[model samples]
Target: MPTIRPSGPADAAVLADIWRASVRATHDFLSEAHFTEIEALVADQYLPQAPLWVIEVDGSPAGFMGLSGAHVDALFIDPRRRAQGLGRSMIAHAARLEGKLTVDVNEQNPQAVGFYERMGFRQTGRSPQDDAGRPYPLLHMRQE
Candidate 1:
């Protein structure tokens, strides 16, 4: 059985490892440089602000997710665990939150764009680069 629960400070390192592995799993499609930066950013900046959840399958951490307001900050399932509905379960959990849920995916990540759409999120708008000048195409969506 798989269980979903809140992440604590103790889980940070494991969450970082998951983030790294998830990025590497999609390396064929994403820019290597971008993935490198993202891994470090997740370890340093994003993880602290977002609320994380650890997915344990039979008492072992199989994946993790991070939620921030209406946006899904991070959601990753080990490559070996893909297609088992963990991602769907995590997204569904986020959708059940108090407000609209959104996620900003790179325009280049078509798989994610389609996945979010399949999850019932609609394209609402776009956004410019942040203070760091990193161009992140925004996907504003909400659960129906």
Candidate 2:
């Protein structure tokens, strides 16, 4: 099992890299411009602003999860290190902190949606655009 720890602003650069790598692997529907824009935001804004936790495997950072109250704002694992239960570990850690987690998943990313569903989340609602008002649709989900 992986251990989770609190992350600070100093971890943003590396976490942003993980976010880019993970998104590149899973979010194949994103355009070049959109990817660039979102990447910048992840590094400059999101990672710094959100309360984050880092997941370490074998004493190295492998992934991160960002939380806002009971909601999951973001979760990303390094592409090379994915599918090894880092994501599941992060979610379980979050569950300990906040019961009944809620998350917004990108509808175009079937991998994420399916993963969330397999984690016992159900779609509670849908939005035509993302929280940032991007064209990508979002599925609001809550763990049950």
How large is the C-alpha RMSD of every model relative to the true structure? 2.5, 1.1
Candidate 1 residue-wise lDDT, 1-144, digit = tens: 688999877777777887777767754554678667767788887766567888988887778887767778677888778778888888877777746577766555666677788887887766665335666555555655
Residue 98 displacement in candidate 1 (angstroms) = 2.4
Candidate 2 residues 25-130, lDDT tens each?
9999888999999888888988888878999888878999989888998889998987898889889889989999999999999999999998999999999998
* C-alpha lDDT of candidate 2 relative to the true structure: 0.90
User: Which candidate leads in TM-score?
Assistant: 2
Give the distance in Å from residue 131's predicted Cα in candidate 1 to where it truly belongs: 7.4
Error of 2 at 12 (Å): 1.4
lDDT of 1: 0.73
lDDT of 1 at 29: 58
Off by over 4 Å in 1: 27-30, 128-132
How many residue pairs collide in each prediction? 1, 0
